[model samples]
Target chain A: MSTARANRMTPYLFLAPAGIVLAVALFYPICYMIYASFLDWNPSQRIGEADFIGLRNYTKLFSDAAFRESMWVTIKFSMVVVTIEMILGVGLALLLDRNIRGMSVLRTLFILPMMIAPIVVGLMWRYMYHPTVGIFNRTLTDWGFDPIPWLADGDWAFASVVIADVWQWTPFIFILSLAALQSLPASAIEASKIDGATGWQQIIYIKLPLMLPVLIVTLLLRLIDSFKVLEVILVMTNGGPGLSTEILSLRINRTASEFRELGEAAAMSNLLLIVLLILTFTMFIYNKAQDARMARLRKVEEEV
Target chain B: MSDKTYDRQNPAFYALLIALVVMAIGPIYLMLATSLKLNVDIMSDSSSLLFMPTLRNYETALCDFLWYEPEHLRRCDPTFGRALVNSLVIGLVSTAITLVIGTMAAYALVRFRFMGRDVVSLWTLMMRMVPPAVLLVPVFGIWTFQFGIDGSRGGIVLVYVALNLPFVIWILQSFIVQVPIQLEEAARMDGAGPFQVFFLVVLPLIKPGIAAASIFTFRVAWNEFLLANALADRNSRTVPVTIVNSLTEFDIDWGVIMATGMLLAIPPIIFTFVASRQIITGMTAGAVKG
Candidate 1:
């Protein structure tokens, strides 16, 4: 074979393993889930034996109160966690965007929570939130205050789980936002300072607007991740306190394993998949738009 | 002149930075403090800033039996030690496989102009975005029925590779592209074949990139919980699953659980500290440059 042709063929050859795995493992399962969602699948029956109920699963999902509640819970959880995490993460980033001694060490330690396994995080917080003997309530009692029902009441349970999630994941946004903050046009911020802009004003007008693109992508990424969170909540609450904290992934998990409704669980997963698909599509488009704009600016520079 | 003036007048900046640092690290300090205390101390004197440290929790974690032996299954048993070993083995092996394959794919994408390259790039990016829970059921079915690799370390390894390959490929591709093509061309013109050029000329240039990608892949596999939890039965449970399983509604043992948490955290913590500079720079550059 010619060298050039051989070179052309090498990439395809190298891509073969990843391509096959993605097809079988990722694409295949998604297709399977889509097909399974169309069936009235029960754990007792084989998939082939299950009745083919086209769109019925989707239709039933729209009116199902439990499904609706779970969806609402997921939406609320994602919004609340992402909102608080973004604020704290960015606030922390803005405050810590500096070159002080030991800053790097502190930044590394800050992101340690994100590196721990979600299940481990869930366990860690559960110990800290233990009702009678957990550090939180114990501290409260030590302070001569009543021990609050952290994981018992519905609202408290939801808030507690959210707190655990925010604790673990806020570092994600912090790192990304810090990167964005550091990469902002340094000259622009300096000019804003010379223009008599205070620190807060410089942040609002100069740094944040410049960091908007990264912030949007980070927010969308966190949103998609939060929607699919299961392990932490599973380990912490097991979707307990009367299902008050049962987000969609946890609900889907229980439906498959606990309720033994494999087909319905598959259908619910597809619904979650669609929601994620929309978010992913939005992110993809946003990325493409940003790239195209950058390319256009490059072309303009070249022409000039 | 601007630098000196700014440095002298940044008192508020220093104060804000100190406050941010404290807030960021406060929880971890709490976790470390809590981990060092006795269970009774943790429960009783939670507000006290100082305490007599105890190594009893670590001792108990190392020498404890939190297993259930079914009457029929006399010979088989599970322990935290086995799970920790399994997690380390699986994580290392999967990361090795991912780095080799992903580096090759990344090199091809960077150096070779071929059909479907753009599509492949887009697909890999999309793969990173796929939620793991969405694939839990189907993956379980695939492993059990189709591949017959269910509940094995090998099965978990395959899943980790499939899940982490995109990240590996994406990061390595950027790193590989930064390597000048002319160097490979020079090696080829000097009688080196493509493979020889890649091995001798190109690989050495991108070691930092490969290191960065390898650490990330290892971290992902090590810290992954859901797929391991779903795929691995008692025989092949991972560290995260074992630690999580320690918690029960009845008769919880906080000491052992904290000890295991400390153990589970040590590897990643050590890796991070050792490669803190490289990993942080790689991640920050990957985000902005991409």
Candidate 2:
């Protein structure tokens, strides 16, 4: 009886440290940020000392053109980056799904770009995009072509950042979808092949339908991560050429540090957090629905 | 499309594979090559590959840590060396703390059906998507004013531990689920207490999960800049923070900066090469599993 009683407390015991840390460091700070959003806070004033101007910071955000622009940039960046990465990544995964030699080596090499620090990634790209000494410009000059203003002009800066992100993240989608593809019920693919389905027909009809679930999850994950990308863009452009590449995260960082408006920054953060939370909640709901559907199908099959 | 085992592909396919590999590794190779070159060679409008490789850049970045003073060094900046130490300490300590607490929590969630278990799992799932950038403002405020631990390695470690716990717990849960419950029961039957059973039986089975969790936790801590930047004082700065700080100069030291970026990037790259399988397993744990 005593042993069982002691065992009853084990779960709490195991959970306490993580619970404490998350509460104090993660959960509390998030709450603090939400409260701070309503106040006219600054770097100098403590949270308690600041005047709580109920939702003024939030109201101010809507009128702020820069904030709107930056938010738009964030959305645009995520959509473009995810779409391009998905196309290239899934395409590469599909094309390279064969029983090839040195596949591990190929994967290991592909993981390099994703594995390296985003700061370093930005640096590599910045060097390559450098006008005088960068490899791209050098090659362009060698071929007697005009050098593009990679990070100088606004439009080009956005494209440059997108290219860097694609280089870094395409392999991630490739690897994930590759795992999904390889794990795909071989019997199903074999049946499709035996049914005289051509490559295109097999991919369009059978393989894609099966891969949709994993692809949606991958897309959502990538979309959420693209919002988190700041350091790479920071190192590359520093949101230069007049806020052209200033995504929401970078804007928040700038607002707090450069502008010294902590409350407004917190409000921006709260908005970004809400967007992410919605995405996460969607993913959670989707996963639950997927499981429930699978169970229902299994039950029906059992009855049959 | 047939499942002809290890079927030979056309030469163009192999060529495409080679091209992809080159494209993937190209920028990394350029960074490495730049880190090894002098500023003069880097700036020179000449053949890029003809320059003599040197460790001058690395020497400059790691000057304070070297046994002997580099003769070529004029003023040794202790910033990179100091930040390197801070990064390593923060990365390792945070990884250790996050892994221990995270694994225990994961084990409990997996083995025991307790109240609020669903809440905890959902919380973990949500927190995994919380970006460090999103945490920047409040973490800075609380650390500085409320917590009073700002500008210290401890503060940085605290945030990192908090940031990584959710994902670590989530990943380890999947791993711990695969552990045979019968083994734990046997251990318990041998008069082993719950703690003993967890430590002796369950812990050993989840080595791959631990490896994956540690790599990811350490990577975030080491590579993190925005929070670390806001929290760290001059002396407590990590490599990423220092590298970003160095980028604001009008005349940038391309060689040394590249070398510093390379240093900051080395651990994750090494982890990738060493444990690619575990890393992949960790990354695809959720989306692919779903």
Candidate 3:
């Protein structure tokens, strides 16, 4: 009887360690964060000592201009970076989807920018954007053009970060879309070609429509990641020139560490979590819908 | 459009490809070059490409590890070297812990139908989106106050394990699912216990998944700065935190700093070259499968 019962208990036994760790380190901390967001907390005091503010932190955030500006910056950064990366990445994928020599070598080279540490990426970009000794300004001056303040000016700093992010992340979209492209139905493509569909038509009508599901998922994944970006911006501009590049993540760090307002940082974190949860849920629902649609299509074809 | 067709591309396409390759790798090459250059050569506009390379910057960055003291150094700052050691230990330990538990969890989830795959996937995806910054405040409060694992390598390892568990579980599930159930049943028929079935049968087959997951976990633990900065005391600071701490100084040492950055980047670069296939597979598995 015990041996038979052990079989029933095996799954939970396998799951227990991961479950305990997640419950303690991840789930508990997140719950703690949510609770702490409601309290007036700080690093100087223990959580038990902090007063329960009951949504004062959230209300205060609504009126806080600096917080709102960072939110705006975060949104603007995500939208701009995601849009540009999607277009450039997908376009490059479509352009390069052909059978080419040295493709895997190119892919290896491409992923190097992403695999490196973001802090290191930030360091490289910061040196390259140095006002006087940077490569860009040096080359510009050598060519008789004016040296621009890449990370000094607010607008320029934002653009500079966007460029750096695009360079690092475009390969992600490229690789994903290329995978989707390569895995596509060869019979359908052969039929389309036999029907004399032009290259642009094939891409516009069939290829894109087929790749939309993967593209949407990629777009959402990138969007979620772009919001989490902090280190590179932290190392590059440090959200200087009056909060131009201060995304929500950076703002959260500053609030917690610099301002020492744990409560407010938790509130900011909660807000960011809500934003991400919405994105994740959207991806989940969209994926479910796509799966259902694919099932239905298969059912219909089988019926025919 | 057929898979076997050999399309003759124009020379312009090749030119564009070359340009893209250069754009992709130029900055990394620049960083490597800057790390090799002396401060004077790095600052000088003329002969930027013609300067002889030197190991002075590397020597300075890694002076703590070197047995013989270098002639150029007036003082040795052991912070970077210490942080490098801490990073490796924390990264390796955390990756090992994460993979061990994550593999079992994935095996259970895949082999035993306790819950729908979609539900677990959604959970993993949600957890994946939780930024380390969001965990900063609560993790600081909890680790410092409640769990009391704060300011130690164990504490940092705990957080890294937790941070990486969801993705590791998710990736390993896809890999474990591919392992045939008949093999497990055959092992069971040989009178092996459940643990033997898992460790002997399941674990060996999912090596690639573990490889991919370990690389990712190690990368995050090694590259992470925000939480590590908050949690690590001076003694346990990771390389990333030290790099960031140094950058806060006004007069940055471009050559030495780039050398530090290069050191931090070397492992991930090596992983990319060695396991680019697995890395790409791990990256696309979620989106393409979706």
Candidate 4:
């Protein structure tokens, strides 16, 4: 009788530990964040002591030009970084999706950037971007060209941050695109070849069409991740020379730590979360729609 | 044309490949070279290539762990070494705990039909969207005020486990879905209990998933800076926190900091080399789900 009961309870038993941990650690903190967003809180004050000032944090953020600039910067950074990385990554994927020797070695090397800590990645780039004793400036000097202000100026600082991110993340998209290309239906390409299709034409038509689903998914994932990028930019520019390079995450960090306004940071976090949630929902809907389209196509083909 | 034989490409193509390889690893190579060089050599305007490479910077970073006192070091700062230990402990312990419970939860989600599974799955998806910066405030508040676990390695571990759980469970779900339900049935028929079936049957089959999940979990715990910085006091600081702290100083020690950065980068690079296939599979499976 006890054994029967245990068997019935097994799944719940397996799940209970994770459930408890997630509730205490993950779920509760998020609920705390939502509540904290409404309160005039500080790091020095306990939650019980913090006054509840509903919606002021959100309204103030909208009025704050600095916050607005950071928001725009975040959006611009995500869009520009994702666009450049996608083009470069996917283009390279197409160019090198061949039975070449050392492909495995190349991939292993490519993943190194993505694998390493973002703080360390930022440090390396910061070192390279240093005006004196830095590799880039040193090289420029060696070539008898004036050393460019990589991180000292506003526009250059933003561009430097973007370059570092592109260097680190492009391989991620490349590897994924290559995987999608490899797993593509060989027969579709073979048929295209039999019709005397040029390499570019085959890629433009069948290959691109087949890889579209993965590409879309990859693009959305990268876009979502680009918003979360904090450390690399933090290390590279620290949002310096002005507010030009201050993305939302960096601004939130400053608000909470430097400014000592936990409520404002929480409000900023809430907005960022909402933006991410919208993007995530878009991906989910896209996936659902694609599923429906695939099902409909299968049904149509069956009737034919 | 043969599938088995490597495809031959143009000379120009090989040149392009070499250039791409060089470009991809260029910054990393620069880091490694800088780490091995002295400050004098690094600051030199003369040819950067030919220089006496020394491990003095590495020695400085790992001074606390050295068996004999390093003579070059006037005095040793124990921060980096302590942080290295903290990072390892937090990363490994959190990863182990996460994998155990996360894999079990994933197994239940895949193999058993239950009311709670939907809730669990929903939390996993939602949690992935929340960034670390977003958590910095609430987690700091909760840990410091509510739980009072701040300034301990355990606090950082808890956050990491929670932070990593969603991805781990999600990745493991796909792998668990592929596990043959028949194997569990056969084991059940042989009088293996539910716990035994999971541990003896299902878990072993999902080794690849475990490998991938563990790598990711450990990587996050190891590499994370923001929350760890906020939560950790001086005693519990991780390597990233230390690296960032050092960077904020007015006069930067390029060679030493680069050496520290190189040390922080070594484990992930090692993982990539050892299990590139698993890491790639995990990346695609977790993201593309196809």
Report the lDDT tens digits of candidate 1 across residue range A161-258: 99988888887888888889877777998898889999889889888988988988889888888887888898888888887999999888788777
Q: Give me the runs in candidate 3 sitting further than 4 Å from their true place.
A: B1-6
| Each prediction's whole-model lDDT (CA) | 0.79, 0.92, 0.94, 0.91
Model 3 clash pairs are none
What would the per-residue lDDT of candidate 1 be over residues B84-194, giving only the tens digit for each residue? 789989999999988887877788877875646557667776777777878777777667767879899999999888888887888888778888888988888898877
Ranking by DockQ: 2, 3, 4, 1
User: Can you write out model 3's per-residue Cα lDDT over A239-281, one digit (the tens) per residue?
Assistant: 9878999999999999998999999999999999999999999
- The digit string of per-residue lDDT tens for model 3 on B1-290 reads 33655678999999999999999999999999999999998888795788899999999999999999999999998988999899999999999999999998999999889899889989988998999999999999999998888899999999999999999999999998899899999999989889999999989999998889989999999899999999999999999999999999988999999999999999999999999999998999899987
Residue pairs in clash, model 4: none
* Stretches of model 4 off by over 4 angstroms after superposition: A300-304, B1-3, B115-122
- Per-residue lDDT tens digits for candidate 2, residues B113-139, read 675655766789899888887788999
Candidate scoring better on lDDT of 1 and 3: 3
Candidate 2: where is the Cα deviation over 4 Å? B1-5, B116-118
Lowest-scoring 10 consecutive residues by lDDT in candidate 1 chain A? A95-104
TM-scores for all candidates: the values are: 0.91, 0.98, 0.98, 0.98
User: What does the lDDT read for residue B64 in candidate 3?
Assistant: 97
Chain B TM-score for the candidates in order: 0.88, 0.96, 0.96, 0.96
Clashing pairs in 1: none
Q: How many residue pairs clash in each candidate?
A: 0, 0, 0, 0
